[model samples]
Target chain A: MAPVVERAREVRYATAAELPEAIVGADVLFAYDFFSSAIPDAWPAADALEWIHVASTGVDAILSPELRASDVVLTNSRGVFDEAIAEYVLGQVLSFAKDLPRSWELQQARRWVHRESERVAGTSALVIGTGQIGRAIARLLRAAGIRVSGSGRRARTDDPDFGTVTAQEDLHEALAGADWVVCIAPLTEATRGMLDGAAFRAMADHARLINVGRGESVVTDDLVTALREGAIAGAALDVLDTEPLPDDHPLWDLPDVRITPHNSGDFVGWRDALVRVFTDNFARWVDEEPLRDVVDTSLGYVPTDGSAR
Target chain B: MAPVVERAREVRYATAAELPEAIVGADVLFAYDFFSSAIPDAWPAADALEWIHVASTGVDAILSPELRASDVVLTNSRGVFDEAIAEYVLGQVLSFAKDLPRSWELQQARRWVHRESERVAGTSALVIGTGQIGRAIARLLRAAGIRVSGSGRRARTDDPDFGTVTAQEDLHEALAGADWVVCIAPLTEATRGMLDGAAFRAMADHARLINVGRGESVVTDDLVTALREGAIAGAALDVLDTEPLPDDHPLWDLPDVRITPHNSGDFVGWRDALVRVFTDNFARWVDEEPLRDVVDTSLGYVPTDGSAR
Candidate 1:
């Protein structure tokens, strides 16, 4: 569908400091940092607010309850971060299989230690949330000869690359055979504690976990307990419920855990990607085409929204 | 032509030390540790010595000059180590791109850091040799969306997966566009010191080098100079001119360089892989089919001997 074209007036900028005049009369709302205390709680229902675009994939913070409840079309920068985070996941999987960290320590000691490594081929991977990021990972892993299974809130029989896909209720069955379990689900109320002790126990003994999604989805205490007891192989985490993880957190000392400070999808060109995503969304909204990455306020997810189809 | 096989009426054990008289007349030979004193300098010219196979890919030390010049056909275990070493290369590539070593150090200090990382997609890789291991690396890199090129003694046009394959003479040209330069070529008289300052200078500034083939193939001093000057982004080395890279070596202090003690392919199942290859070759010999991986006595590389084909 061709987008509805709204006439352009002067481009209004919300500089995050001084509010650029009331955008009620403007045709577009470029909300970069409005969620961070810069935006007024309420505004007049104006022409400027016809299309609201967020810089982040998750619109929970940016969308005031009323904004989401309103008719203003909302879109997000969702696809921008997939390649970066998927690459991060692949890197973590390789590091774990090849024992690169241990090799580095041995190198430091000038020792010729030989360690056996597992091949990714013939291994099974369980990907939670068959979103853009998860789909991209499935394609890449499938190319490498891995068997990938995807899990989301509902079964997706259309995604053929993932051999066995199921809804949230079947997560346990999915994890039973996976050698690598990737968590990329957003933090919805239902998913907040989805990966708790029970989930951990379902994973294979040699399974490795990677979280580039919402940290709250995984119960940190359960993860630590699993790692300490050797219930699972290891983990590589780029997200946490708390930013700047506390220095005294026991997770820091977990023997097989790898931690990154919430930077999985951030890269050199990420800002440019973010800008591109927003610019395209703006164009789509201006032309009145169904907006891409439209969030389902009720479900709290950027819906499939027919964009993928 | 099938491999020549003979029956053993009597067998002798050199490493086992207890030679049985019942095996003295054995026509077939299985010499393990037979060279504890000295490798037999003279070819025995035993009528039963129709086939000789070495467990190692490199038979330089195993084959005495006489054995190499002998009339008996011989083969070496060439395919055994390829997969294991290719797995190692994948590890190094992932580690470098993910900033894994730095992350590990930070984790140890309980410091949370978020660093920019690289994606493997759309990058160019240069494999210096187009042998079993190099081909394996190419397959993995291709699966990861990297443009792969290779250099071999002879360039064949049929291998279209290689973006820009070339003959050995064009290696410098191949290195120019490479984001990753992997060396897995055999160590031959002509290949020794092949990777020097001049070669490193030709590589892109952000490119990484991984040497898993042979230590003698790289000039350590030149490599160190190139790395120190930032001629290339970094290096992940599994082999060095000297094994167990001396404690005081300057390369150890370079933060950008990752060192391993020549242990790229020594995995748990390596011995079994060698035995399997050997057994297959023996079976082939018994069938009077052409032997595989026969070395050219004159060139020290398999297949340089035109008679093998």
Candidate 2:
């Protein structure tokens, strides 16, 4: 970013308010803050805007009818978060399977209690997205000997990463059979609030949910009701609908829920890695070469050929 | 055991005290409580004993000079614990690399702080045993892309699971290069109190130790001091120098130390699995077939050809 700022002939910086004026004649708009949702507000002033490069995965925040209809090619930082997020999801899975939370409590009480733990090798997991991040999660969990399938936009079989890809419409059927459910779908028209009461009821009572995707993908109220009613055994959420979840939030004191701030894909050097992705994509745009991680505005994600890697 | 007991003409069950009299007319002895030291004391009365089977791994507790010098064949439940223990160790490794303990602390207080986690894929681990359980750990960690090596009784290259197995004498040199040092070695004359002050000092300050081996494998005081001075970053002990560690013990509340009762290899059906192991070996012994999991008493564990599977 320092090098790009130094080398450019003209560079304009703006907050959400100033973005309208600052974007007046810009050929390239770099949405450094991907979550700000400022791009659409300034879309009318982007007279020369040829492209918009977001610094994070999930371009839902910036996507709108005007931008999607316009010819502004959009690219996202995809690869940077794959491995880190995959590791996080696997860690959360193991935490529940091994009863690590109870162990922590016992350790605090100086209690030496022995309990039998469970194994993931023979368990089944259903990943709710088929994008890069979801594929990464599938690969990692499969590596641990867990059976992995996907609930994607369409149903298919013999996928490279997820052997069986069930269409989103069949999510309930898939949920009923899985021991673990992971949500990594983007916040989109059909995806938002997908995990409601019905979905929870569809899951086995011993099943657990791990959400590293958008918080809105799950219905918060339904999740609370499900937890209270013992619809699911536990949940480990990295993303929550109401983040920094209010201190009085009941999920905080729930019997078997684990919460962490939304930093799942963030590992040391991630910022540099994201910058490198942006710079590399920028160079490709400048050279008129094919860009990587190009998001199809209509599809809302970078489509894959049924292969995880 | 029920089926066997129902058919036998002279079925005998005994407490440790009665074990001496029980041994007077026994042809085969099954040491159900593996940790009991009654075998050596009962050895003098074992006039007809031909085989002894222990319902656990780690024959160290029951191994005695008299029994070793006797003609009685020693067999242990070895294969039962491999995969279960491997899963536990990997879960523990992820727990550390992902900062789960601190996440638990933050979650309890309803804090939403974001912090970067670490990946084990590119890091290195040194497993301090080359037996079945240790090799299982090596295979699992290596699958996650960690560079896995071994420290055993001998130094060799091209070993199946661990590419290069360092000799036990060079443990200090090996410890210096490892980010995670896992001890799964059995307690033997050479291994007892092996991880002392010099060993901890030899490890990098950022390195962490995980002991799933034996309580006596590490010197507790030295480990406490090492953790205090940051000689090593942290530790996760499934087996400590003292079981049910004393309430006032300083190690209990140490900043980064996590303690769990010694149940790393025990899973939901582990007791049944152990019984199956013993029963299967008994059937083989009665038929005069070569015993399975035969402990080379002098070597102190079941020797492997180095293949993890």
Candidate 3:
């Protein structure tokens, strides 16, 4: 409701390393802080700039004091990676259901093994943090005939997006009922280490946990223990507390755990998608139209804010 | 028009190996002699058998001269595995599209490699053999926003089941336009080697082939050649010319090939589904009603005679 708008006069590109230099003289500044070798020394003035867009969805690192204090509009590429990440989640689920890895091993040994697999239908999914990724995950799960729920900062009884909505304090109740627990919660102060030993213990033994969000939201040691003790059936992680987990990392040796580098939403055309979203926001800024997917910085994300857009 | 209706008589359980012993002593015997550990040597007499329901949709082995001489009702498990097979096909398509195998490799190395992936939403699929499996394939494809067509031995333009029902000779046209070619044809003498070098050449360079019906319906050597030469993009095979493709088989080494041990329609509770179908048929037989999915000795399978129920 604070209505922080941008009035563009001149543009600056403060990306870490070399970039396409296409927006040299435009009245907009585009930055790729995530891929840069070093941070830019100088910051753009807020009053002189009308729009500021980050290439990555998570703006925690790039949210400098000047960018925050300035009244210019701030938007991140939120919806660009939704479909790709959703597809990745579906692929991992199917790969597990179909026992593809075991089949690959059997093929290598020329052993004609016949293993039965479970279906995705009639399952229940609890998606923590009802953000873009969470919504996409819910849509795909629903399409697969699974009932889905959501857990957020506040409880909402009338929200039709989730069959069950539980407040953050009641996360355990939601975890206990979920057949598939998907962690897409932002790594905010309130949600950090949210899924720990207690939450894992509350999960159904047959449930599968998938994390495509921040790794800090889950306690890695507790997840490993849950998997080892069969507290939960299986898990697929695309993000870890530490990027490029060491080869000797104990997490790699877990039997029912799937570990991937944090590339779930990073597709080949992803850069272009980010640019497209930013360009659309840029066009909207010049027209004095309200921007989409603005970060709260205080609440970690803009609240459903009545519109649910 | 041939009503092969037999009298109340004995039933032999030749396919007892594939099915459970509980299915024996049935008024209508299901002779599933497919890859069984030899025939049930202590089987009941043929004279007492009122009907011989084959577990497999194809009855090539059971359609012998002696069995044909009898008036026993010969039904097949035609519709039992359609949905399961369709799910398997969808799994393969998604796996290929999302680059699951490559992701699996990168996960092992703890490397974050992002790549572009194709979506199946707007592709065209050509399903050969417009039977239960073919119809199921079309339905799933339609759900995924894909256009689908089917070709059969007999052409029927008025049939809504297939977008383009063409004769066997017109298969080239079907293959030429298809982005995916699914072969579920019966393994009659005519269908054997139907997908040979010429057929592969006719397919689009980006098309993929999936075979779930019968192994003998495709030419293994020609298929290997097509994949190796990039005549067609890739293939996911459930059934093959050999049950367990020998360690030395060349098809196993093909880069674009995915080989499974003929378990496309196999999943958890699949046995229950087969039993359920058989139980329904058994009830109909007890009521002296016409059976469904009766095998047309000439065409392999068709609906039961119009007047028999």
Best by lDDT: 2
**Model 2 stretches with alpha carbons more than 4 Å out:** A2-5, A306-309, B33-35, B307-309
What is the CAPRI rating of model 2's predicted complex?
Answer: medium
Against the true structure, whose DockQ is highest?
A: 2
TM-score for each model = 0.87, 0.96, 0.84
**Residue-wise C-alpha lDDT for candidate 2, range B1-309, written one tens digit per residue:** 657634753668888988888788788877764445778887788899888888777888788988778788888888788887888888888888889889889988878888998887899999999899998899888877789999999899988899999999999999999999999999999999999999999999999999999989999999999999999999989998777898999988998898888888878998888778877777776677988888899888888885532
Candidate 1, residue A153: the lDDT equals 76
Q: Order of candidates by lDDT, top first?
A: 2, 1, 3
Residue B306 local lDDT, model 1:
15
Compose the digit string of candidate 2's lDDT tens values, residues A118-196. 9778899999998888888998898888999999998989788898999999999999999999999988889999999
Looking at model 1, residue B27 earns an lDDT score of 40
Is model 1 an incorrect, acceptable, medium or high docking prediction? medium
Clashing pairs in 3: A7-A50, B9-B48, B10-B48, B10-B49, B290-B309
Please count the clashing residue pairs in each candidate, in the order shown: 17, 0, 5
Looking at candidate 2, what is the lDDT of residue B277?
Answer: 81
lDDT of 1 by residue, B79-130 (tens): 6676667767877887788788888889889999778877778888899877
Evaluate all candidate structures by whole-model CA lDDT and list the values in order: 0.73, 0.86, 0.71
Report DockQ per prediction, comma-separated.
Answer: 0.57, 0.78, 0.38
Model number with the top TM-score: 2
